[model samples]
Target: MLFERVESEGLAHYSYIVGDGNEALVIDPRRDCDVYPKMASKEGMRITGVLETHRNEDYVIGSVELSARTGAEIFHADGHLNYRYGEAVEDGMRWKVGRLEVEAISTPGHTLGSMSYLLRDSGGEPWIVFTGDALFAGDLGRVDFMGMDRAEEMAGLLYDSIFDRLLPLGDGVIACPAHGAGSVCAASIADRKWTTLGIERKRNPRLQIESKEEFVEDMAVALEMPPYFKEMERLNLVGAPLLSSLPEPSPLPAREFAIASVEEIVLDTRMELAFGAAAVPGSLSIWLGGVPSFAGWFLPYDKEVLLVDETGDPGEAVRRLRRLGFDSIRGYLAGGMVAWHTAGMESSSIATANVHDLCLRLDRQEKERGWILDVRSGAELQKSGRITGAHQIHLTELPERIGEVPMDRHVYIFCGSGLRAMVAASILKRRGWKDLTVILGGLAGWSSAKCPVVK
Candidate 1:
């Protein structure tokens, strides 16, 4: 048996290609799925089937594109909405590819129709279970996406699916999840590449809770849902467009870029710190690493994207955005930020403040009444007290709720760390709001300084 894990870093998504003899099967593929075919070809295997554990909510699914290329049959769990593409898979249904055996188990917690695929060895012994979003290495999937009213019900379903359906398969089975650390799907997932069911069952926090009611209640806790999730769910149900090739972006000179049409958005893919120092006016600063998860929240799906990265590779940034269905990237800044500066293009910057500075401002009551913009999630704030008089607006919602931020007052933005704070500042600066400052260490820094916090 042959198995390979394909990871999409920014999204923290994992897909698998398992094969034996001559046939291969792809599980939970991303939109830019050409790598699977290339890998299969190098191994002298023909792609035969595609399996989706559930309809994804983060990145676009690549099943349609893969099936188009390889004539592979797409199989997904049958429940909830009727997916326009892919055949509905029921519980206990099995598929065979040479000596490799695949069996689907109904596990509806992450989604109403979630399925966990059990891959058995030639001997018919269960080897590994692809748990999808139902279970992760260290954390379980969030149940909030389905809706607040159904949160408890979904959590209960997930608990049963994990405790009754998945764990009973035995401890030795390797547990391969759809996502890992850095993904929005789970809050406390471990950074490890993959883990076994035995390890997760023993060490995972959610698994340790014995009572189903407690597990359901624990899962109902506050969680931040990214704004783009709704769009992804919609596109996944109807089937996402197949990308024959990745979108190629051209490099445009700074002078030409300066007067270029306003239709295109200038995406600064530089590090948050560098972006905070200086960036083109009205440009959105979402570093290359965050393009997949954050760009979709603020960037329009129709407009062309023009990348501005001085440090990271533009090719990679484009690919990450494309994976999330941002296909109309026209090109990148020809000379990057340095060229923009050399050309004397107008640039904007946000000031950074440490916890000490924040305290001083609070002491002095800084003119116009400074407003603290806490961009962290509600759950984080509840766990760790927030600054007094801070208004909470998650970073993902900043674009639509930008007006809620007071323009007359000095705005100090912050998250668990300074990264999200800088992102918030960039959005405000782009919208022509000035007098912005980012609290260097966010709430963590504030506590480190021994500053008083309001719970």
Candidate 2:
């Protein structure tokens, strides 16, 4: 049997291609799914099946697109909401790919119709289990997606699915999950690549709880769901348009880019320092690495996006945005910010301050009228110490909670390492808030400088 795991970087999503003899099956594919077919071709196998564990909430699934490209049959769990594409697969349903047998196991917890696929060897011994969002390396899928009213019910169902259906499949089965560490699907997934049922059963903190009631209670905690999730859910259910159907982002000269920025969303995918130094006026600063995780929070589905990357290549940014269901990319600045400067186009820059500057400013906060805005997550604030008198709003929740940030003060934003702080600054900039400054190195620099923090 042949197996390959493809990891989509910014989203930290995982898709797999499993083959035996001359046929292969792809599970939980990402929207840009050419990797699967290319891998299959290299292995001298034809992709005959595409499977989804559940309706994805983060990135657009590539099931329909892959099926169109490879002539593969698409399969997903049955009895959930009606999916517009793919055949509805029921529990215990089995299919043959080459000489390998793949069976779908009903494990509805993350969502009502979540399924886990068990792949058996030629001798009928279970070798690997595609747990989808049901299980991860160090954590289980969040059970709150079904809404707060049914969170407990979903958690209870997840407990039963893990303790009964999954663990009983035996400890040795290699467990493959749909997401990894950076994904929003799980709060604290392990960074490691490979894990087994035995490893997770032994080391997973949540799995250590024996009582179902306790597990249910523990898993019912609410997490901030991204606004784009609703759009992703809708698109994934009805199926997304193929990549070929979408318009490719072209390179536009600085003069043309300036005109486009007025009508389209301007996204600058450069580092925090570069963005802080100088950027296209009114462009949103997300940094190329942050596009997949945070772009959905700020970008609207209706508007076209014009990108400005430092390398002058918006291909990566476009891919990341498309993965999160942002398909209306108009184009990118041809020569990036340098070209804009050469064209004598107007530019904007956000001020930067260090941790020491923050400390001295805090000493004179009453006279300076400066405010510190912490954009880190609540979990990070709890794990690490927090700055006293700083207003706390998670970066993901900034859009809805923007009012809480005082408009009269000189707002100094800081995140874990300043990447998110820059993004937050851009959000504020777009909202017409002036006197913004990003604290360089953020809390890490504060600690390194022996600054005090409140627990």
Candidate 3:
């Protein structure tokens, strides 16, 4: 038997290709799914089946695209809602991929129709179970997607799905989850790729709760839902258009790029320091690596996106946006910001201040009228205390709460690292807040410098 894990970086999504003889199966594929087919061919196998653990809310599902490319039959859980494509798979239903037997088990928790696939070896002994969002390495999937009213009920279902359905499969069964660390699917999922049921049962904090009531109560904590989730859910239900069907984002020179920028959103995906030094005026600054984690919070789905990528490889930015279901990529700036500056096009820069500078400004609090805005999440603030006088608003909630930020006062944006602060600075710049400065190194640098923090 052959097993390989394909990781979609940034999103922390994991898709697998499992084969036995000449037949293979793909589980929970990402939207850009060319990797699976190539891997199968290299292993001298034909992909005959595609399985979805659940209708994901974070990223577009690639089941239809994979099926279309490999002639594979798509399988997902049978109920809760009607999916436009893929065959509805009922619990206990089995399929053969060479010598391996794939059986679907209803594990409704993360979603009402969530399923886990159990793979049996040639001898009919359980080998590995593909637990979708229902289970992760060190944490269980969040059960709040069905709305707050149904959160507790869903959490209870998740308790049953894990303690009753999945755990009963045996301690030796290896658990391969759909997502790994850094995914929003789980609050604190471990960084490890795969873990056996034995290890999770022994060490997972969620599993320590013996009572279902306690488990549900613990899991009912509300999490910040990204604005893009509803859009992703809507698109995944009907099946998003294939990558081939979308308009290809072209590379535009400075002149054409300026023309496009008048109508489209300019997303500058350069690093924080580079963006702070110089950027296309009015462009939103989300570093290329930070796009996957924060783009969904602020980017409008209806508008086309034009990238200002300094890395010269804008295709990667395109792929990251595509995974978030942002298909309206107009194009990328051909020569990046340098070309625009050389062409005499207007550019903007955000001011940067170090931790010591911030401290000096705070010392003169009575004289200087500036607000230190902490854009890190509430959870982060709780983990690592914030500056004494800093105002708190999560970066995701910044747009809605923009009115609260004082336009007259100088705004010094800070996040866990400088990445999110740069993003906040961009948002403020676009919104016409001129007196803005991003605090470099954020709280990390301040803490290292032994700066006082209010817990």
Q: Tell me how far the alpha carbon of residue 399 in candidate 1 is from the true structure, in angstroms, after superposition.
A: 4.0
The digit string of per-residue lDDT tens for model 1 on 40-103 reads: 8888898999999998889899998899989999987645677899889899999897897999
Instruction: List the candidate 3 regions with Cα displacement exceeding 4 Å.
Output: 364-366, 447-451
Q: Which 10 successive residues of model 3 have the least lDDT summed?
A: 442-451
Best by lDDT: 2
Ranking 1 against 2 by TM-score, winner: 2
List the candidates' TM-scores in order. 0.87, 0.96, 0.96
Rank candidates by TM-score, best first.
3, 2, 1
Please give, for residues 1-455, the per-residue lDDT of candidate 2 as tens digits.
67999999888999999998899999999889889889989989999999889989999999999999999999976456888998988999998977789999989889988999999998899989999999999999998898889999999989888989999999999999999998888889998789999999999999999799999989998877889999999899899999999988989999999998999999999999999999888889998888888898899999999998989777888888989889999999998888899999989999998887787767655566477899998888888888876888998888889999889978999888889999999999989998999988756556422236877
Supply candidate 2's per-residue lDDT for 281: 82
lDDT of 1 at 224: 68
lDDT of 1: 0.84
Clashes of 2: 0
The best-first sequence of candidates by lDDT reads: 2, 3, 1
The local distance difference test score of each candidate is: 0.84, 0.89, 0.88
What TM-score does prediction 3 earn?
Answer: 0.96
